[model samples]
Target: MALTADSPLTELLQENPKAAEILMRFGMGCVGCALASGETIRQAAEGHGIPLPELLEALGIEE
Candidate 1:
């Protein structure tokens, strides 16, 4: 699924375990944290200072 800032981390993680690799590759590995639980893909990427295009590509989502 294409991800957006409104996409729930919990839901995304459940549907796409590959998302963890994408997030961590961008230096966001706190997938189990409370803050991460509610954070969206864009939010997390921004938080980690990851470029949106790069993050999107890594997640297999077209930007």
Candidate 2:
């Protein structure tokens, strides 16, 4: 499945291993967090005070 800003954190990590690195660089430590299963990329970005567009771009995911 194509990755998108709405994709769940777990789905994102599963689709792109590099995403974990990018998320970490953005100060999001959701890689192994339980909430990853339910948290969408957009939600994570917002929760972490990251710009949604920036996060999506870094993850190579479309908004």
Per-residue accuracy of model 2 over 1-63 as CA lDDT, tens digit each: 788888889888787878889999999875687877799999988888999998888877778
The candidate scoring highest on TM-score is 2
C-alpha TM-scores of all predictions: 0.78, 0.91
Model 2, poorest ten-residue lDDT window? 28-37
lDDT of 2 at 41: 91
Give the C-alpha miss distance for residue 39 in model 2, angstroms.
Answer: 0.3
Question: Residue 7 lDDT in model 2?
Answer: 81
Q: What is residue 25's positional error in candidate 2, in angstroms?
A: 0.2
C-alpha lDDT of all candidate models, in order: 0.77, 0.85
lDDT of 2 at 24: 94
Error of 1 at 17 (Å): 1.0
Q: Write the per-residue lDDT of candidate 1 for residues 4-24, one digit (tens) a residue.
A: 555777877887887787777
